[model samples]
Target: MNILVLCTGNSARSILGEAIFNQLGAGRVRAYSAGSRPKGVPHPGALRLLERRGIDTNSFRSKSWHEFTGPDAPPIDIAITVCGNAAGEACPVFPGTPIRAHWGLPDPADVDGSKAEVDAAFEATWLALTARVAAFLALPFEKLDPRELADHLAEFGRMEGAA
Candidate 1:
């Protein structure tokens, strides 16, 4: 199955989600990312965080959602919005009847302060997405129907960090 994770910037949360899903899904699922408004580059802190986890950040780039709407574009099995702004905005109509879900995370790029503080924000977001993606991968995909899978994905969106 092919999945597209969307956000406003396509720089941090969506990028991290794509990488995590791609890694955990193995060959069972392929993941892609796009944004309502491209940031033109992956966020530096996001790159650092992924690198620290041993995931390559070289292939990531911010891209517009329009790329997924064309005839030659890959048909998306699922499209998940990973931030509040992107979830609220009107998205490009995907070729297939793509299942939509929201897995909103706090925007690490929006966090301000020292370099250490910024890195901490990105790390926290990464950990949150990693946990949710791990839960998603644990689901029995072969047995559940597409709608059920979408429902479960949405449930992942609502999870809060352990206090």
Candidate 2:
């Protein structure tokens, strides 16, 4: 399965979700991320947390959702929105009917504190997103129909850290 994680900024939460999904999904799913308004680069705190976890930050960059609009873009089987703004915005998770789920989270980049506190907020966001991604990776995707899969994804959105 191919998945796309979306957020307004694509700087923090969406980036974290992308990493978590890609790492845990292994070769079972290909995950990508984008934003309604690209931030150009990822948030420093997010990059820090990812690097600390030994996940390569070199391939990550804040990008627009339009990049996936081209005919050459990979087909998305699922599209997850991690923030309200992107969830509400017009998304092009097209070419087919892809399951959509919202896993809204408070932006760690919006946290105000010293280095440690800021890093802690990022860590918390990471953990929350990790939980949802891991749950999806654990599901028996081959058996579930589209409706069942959608229901499960919606249930996951209501888990901890839900906004």
Highest lDDT against the true fold, candidate: 2
Alpha-carbon shift of residue 51 in model 2 (angstroms): 0.5
* TM-scores of all candidate predictions against the true structure: 0.94, 0.97
In angstroms, give how far residue 90 of model 1 lies from its true place.
Answer: 0.9
lDDT of 1 by residue, 1-163 (tens): 8889999999999999899999989888899999999999999999998898899888999999999999999999889898999999999888989989998888999989998999999989888988888888888876789889988998888888521
- Candidate 2 ranges beyond 4 A from true positions: none
TM-score of model number 1: 0.94
lDDT of each: 0.90, 0.91
| Top TM-score prediction, candidate number | 2
Could you list the CA RMSD of all candidates, in the order they appear? 1.8, 0.9
Q: State the lDDT of candidate 2 residue by residue for 57-108, as single tens digits.
A: 9999999988877788889889999998998998974767888999998889
Give the C-alpha miss distance for residue 40 in model 1, angstroms: 0.6
